[model samples]
Target chain A: MNKNINHLVNETLDSFAHLQKVAAPDGLNERILQRMNQPKGSKEVYLFRNAQWLIAALVIGIVCNVYLAISYNNKGESNGTETSTISSFESHFRLETTTNLYE
Target chain B: MSELQLIAELKDGNQQAFIKLIDLYKHLVFNTVLNMVQQFEEAEDLTQEVFIQVFQSIQHFRGDSKLSTWLYRIAITKCLDWQRKNNAKKRMNSMKSIFGLDGHQDIIPDFVHPGIQLANKEKATMLFKALKQLPENQRIAFTLIKADGLSYEEVSEIMQTSIKSLEGLMHRAKENLRKSLEQFYKS
Candidate 1:
C-alpha cells in the first residue's frame, strides 16, 4: 500500500513536469520600463506636489500676523487718546470747581 | 551580449541593456513565481516587481552568484512576501466574518495552471491542493526541484542551504507530499 501510494504521488507530481511557462501579459515590459524611467522615491514628489498648499498656508499665516499687529496698534492708539481726553476733562472740571469755590 | 557585459551596462544605467536583460529572464522569473503563487495575474505582477527591483539594485549586486541565481532569489523572496501578506489578509477577513463585521465568503483555492495538459488537469489540480498545504520551505524545495527544473545544487544555492540539508529538505518534501496525497486520496 505504501509502495502504491508513493508511486501515485510520483506520478501525480511528474504529470506537472511539462508545465509550460506562462507568457507575461502584453505591454508588461513596457510598463516596467516606463515605471523605471519615471522618478523614484515618491516622498519628494508628494512634497513638491503640495508646495502650493504649503506656500498658501505660509502666506495666510503672515497675513494674519500683520492684520493682528495693525489692529492691536489701532486699539492701543484709541485707548491712549481716550485716556488723554479723560485727563484733560478732569483738569478742566477741577479748575471750574476751584473758581466756583473762590467765588 | 555576454552576461557580464550586460551586467556592466546595466550597472552603468544603460536602458537598452536593461531591456535586453528583461527580455532574457522574464520567462524564467514569471514561471517560477507562477508556480509558487498559483495566481496568473499576481505572478505576472510579481515578475514585474522582481525586475524593477533588479534594475534599481543592480548596482549593489556583488557578482557573488550568477545573475540568474540572484534573480531567482529575488523572485522567491517576492513570492514568499506576497504569500505572507495574502495569508494575513485572509486571516483578517476571516476574523472580520466571525465577528459579523463582514459577510462570510469562502476563499477559493486557485489551482489553474494554463500550462497543464488537459488529460493531467484533474490530477494536477489535486496535487496543487496538497502542495499548498505543505509548509513554506518544503513547498519551495519541492517546487524548485520538481516544477522549476532546478538542480539540487542550484536549489541549494538559491535557498542558501548546504547540499546535505537541501537533500534532506527535498526528501522530506517528497515524503510529506506523498502522505498528504495519500490522505487526500483515502478521503
Candidate 2:
C-alpha cells in the first residue's frame, strides 16, 4: 500500500512537468529564416568542401580497407603456422566475445 | 490540397503551398522536435530545418511513409546531429579546461519543457528526463508510443523492428524510466 501510494505520488509529480508554450519572445522564426537564407558565400566553396570531405573519406576508407584486408590476410597466413592458430571453436565466438570484451 | 498537389505546386514555384505545408506541420514538427530537444527555440529551429530539408529532398519523398513520419525522421536526425556537435564541443572544451586553459563547459541549449504544465511537475520532468536518458532505440520507441501515441505495431513499422523487438525496446524503456523516477518519487 505504501509503495502504491509512493508510485502515485511520483506519477503525479512526473505529470506536472511543463505543459505549455510562451511564444519564443517573437521574431525568433524570422531570425531563423534570415540565418537560413544567408548566402553560403559561394557554391564553389561548398563544392570544394564536399570535394575535400570525399577525398578524405576515400583516402581513409582505402587505407582502412587495405589495412583490414592486409591484417586479415596476415591472420590467415599466420594461422597456416601451427603456433599462431587457436582452436576452431574460437572462430564462432569472435563476434560475441569481442562485444563482451568492450561492454 | 493533396500532398501530391503540394509537391507539384512547390516544384512549380508556388510559394503559398510551401508556406501552407510549413503552417500545417509547424506544430507537429515543433512538438516532435520538443520531445527530442527539450528547448522550445531549438525545437522551432529544428522544425524550420526539417521543412527546409523536406523542400530539398522533395524529390525523394517516395510516399512510402506518411509525410509526417518522414518529417519526424528528418527532424530527429537533425536534432541528433546537433546534439552530437554540441557534445563534441563540450568534450573539446573539457579537454582544454583540463589543460589549464579557460573555456566554457558547453551550454546545453535551454528550452521550456511542455510537460511542466501538468499538476505533477517534478514527476513529469523526471519521467521525461528519464525518457531522454534512454538508449537511442528505446528513446525513439518510447517517444513514438507515449508522445506520438502510436500503437506498438505502428512504432514497429516506423522503427523497422519486429513487433517483438519493439516490445523489448518498450519494456526496457519503461523499466529505465521507472528506475530513474523511483528515486525522484521516493524523495
Candidate 3:
C-alpha cells in the first residue's frame, strides 16, 4: 500500500511531463486585431459619454456653493445684529468699547 | 524581425507588426492562460485580452526584461484577476444560498488539460485539483515551472522573485501536492 501510494504521488507530480503546447483558438488574431482597432474612447470621451454624471456632479457642486454662500450671508447678518446689540448695551451702560483691563 | 524592432513597430501601432507579435507569442500566452484558467474558451478570451493590453501598453515597455518575460507577467496577472473574479462570484453565490435566494451554485467540473499525455490524464486531473488547493503563490510558481515549461530563472524574472525563493515555493508546493495526492489515492 505504501509503495503504491508513493507511485501514485510521483506519477501525479510528474503528470506534466511531455506536455504539448496547445494553440490559441482559430481566428483569435483577427478577433484581437478587430478589438484593437475598435476605437478606444479617450478619457475625455469617456467623461463626455457619462455627461449625465458630470452634469449631476456640477449641479451638486453649484447647489453646495449656493448653500454655503447663503449660510455665510445669514451668519454675517447675525454677526452685524450682535455687534449692534453689544454697542447698544455698551452705550446704555456708559462702557468704553476698548477698555484695557490689563493696563 | 528583431524583438526590439517588433516592439518599436508595435509601439508605433503598426498592424503588421502586431500580427507578427501575436503569431510569435500567442501559443505561449495561450498555454499559460489555459493551464491557469483550465477552460479553453475563457483562456482564449483572456489570451486576447493579454495581447490587446500588450498592444495598448507597448509604449511603456522599458525593455528591462525580455518581451516574453513581460508577456508572461501580463498573462499571469490577467489569469489571477480572472480567478479572483470567479472566486468572488462563488462567494456571492454561497451568500445567496445562505439567504435562501435562488443562487445557482457554480459546480466546477473536473478539468482535463488537453496538453497532458493520454496515459497521464487521470493522474493529471488529480494533480490539478491538488494544485488548486495550494496557496496562490505556490500554485503560480508551480504552474509556471511545470505546466508552462518555464525555467527557474525565467519564472523568477516573470514572478519578480529570487530563484532561491522560487525554489522554496516549488518545494512547498510539491510537498503539499504530494500529501494531497497521497490522501486522494489512499481514499
Task: Specify the highest-TM-score model's number.
Answer: 3
**After superposing candidate 3, which stretches have Cα over 4 Å from the reference?**
A39-103
Pairs of colliding residues, candidate 3: none
lDDT of every model, 2 decimals: 0.85, 0.69, 0.88
Worst 10 residues of 1 chain A by lDDT: A81-90
Candidate 2 docking class:
incorrect
TM-score of every candidate relative to the true structure: 0.75, 0.69, 0.79
TM-score of 1: 0.75
**Worst ten in a row by lDDT for model 2 chain A:** A81-90
Lowest lDDT 10-residue stretch of candidate 2 chain B: B109-118
Report the candidate with higher lDDT, 1 versus 3. 3
Candidate 2 lDDT at B141 equals 83
B118-159: candidate 1 lDDT, tens digit per residue: 887877888788888888988999899888888999999999
| lDDT for residue A76 in candidate 3, whole number 0-100 | 47
lDDT score at residue A9, model 2, on the 0-100 scale: 51
RMSD of each: 13.1, 12.0, 7.1
For model 1, state the Cα shift of residue B91 in Å.
Answer: 1.1
* Per-residue error (Å), model 1, residue A74: 46
The residue pairs found clashing in candidate 1 are none
* Each prediction's DockQ against the real complex: 0.42, 0.16, 0.62
lDDT tens digits by residue: candidate 2, B33-147:
7777777666777777887787778877777877777777787788788778877988898998899898668455333365445455555555666676788888888776776
